[model samples]
Target: MALSTSNRAAPSSYLSLGEVAAELGITDRTVRNYVARGVLPAHRIKGSRLIRVRRSDVDALLQPVPVTDGGDAA
Candidate 1:
């Protein structure tokens, strides 16, 4: 799916945690953990378990994570 550039300034205006995960190519759990660890900010919807993640926050996570070439630990 193509990401809309029309609202680039406000990307997270309507994105959910799941959507963020898809955009970042990560698992939903990882997105949730971000929220848990305070890396990503989220807002709880009234009368619902749904959580919304800001687009800017997700964008920040796109930075490359340092890792070893192999699957071994650094």
Candidate 2:
């Protein structure tokens, strides 16, 4: 049977804390820190302590910063 569009879950990439830490070249604890600071969105399984971070949320943090014009330069 074909699944209904309304019943489909949104497409999203999720990574374990260790996986995210490896991808970012940081420690797992650091990933946890980001989650604690609300810098990254995360979720934990019911009755489990494991945390998962959304890949899109991590990508948002990697966005390039815009450069400013020299108009305000002394």
Query: Best lDDT goes to which candidate?
Result: 2
Weakest 10 consecutive residues, lDDT, candidate 2?
1-10
Tens-digit per-residue lDDT, 2-69, candidate 2: 11122223334767788889989999888878877777777764455556667887788789879888
Model 2, position 44, has a per-residue lDDT of: 69
Candidate 2 has a TM-score of 0.70
Q: How much lDDT does each candidate structure score? A: 0.68, 0.69
RMSD of each: 9.3, 8.4
* CA lDDT, candidate 2, residue 25: 93
lDDT of 1 by residue, 1-74 (tens): 11222322333375787898899899999888877877777766555656776676677777788976887677
lDDT of 2: 0.69
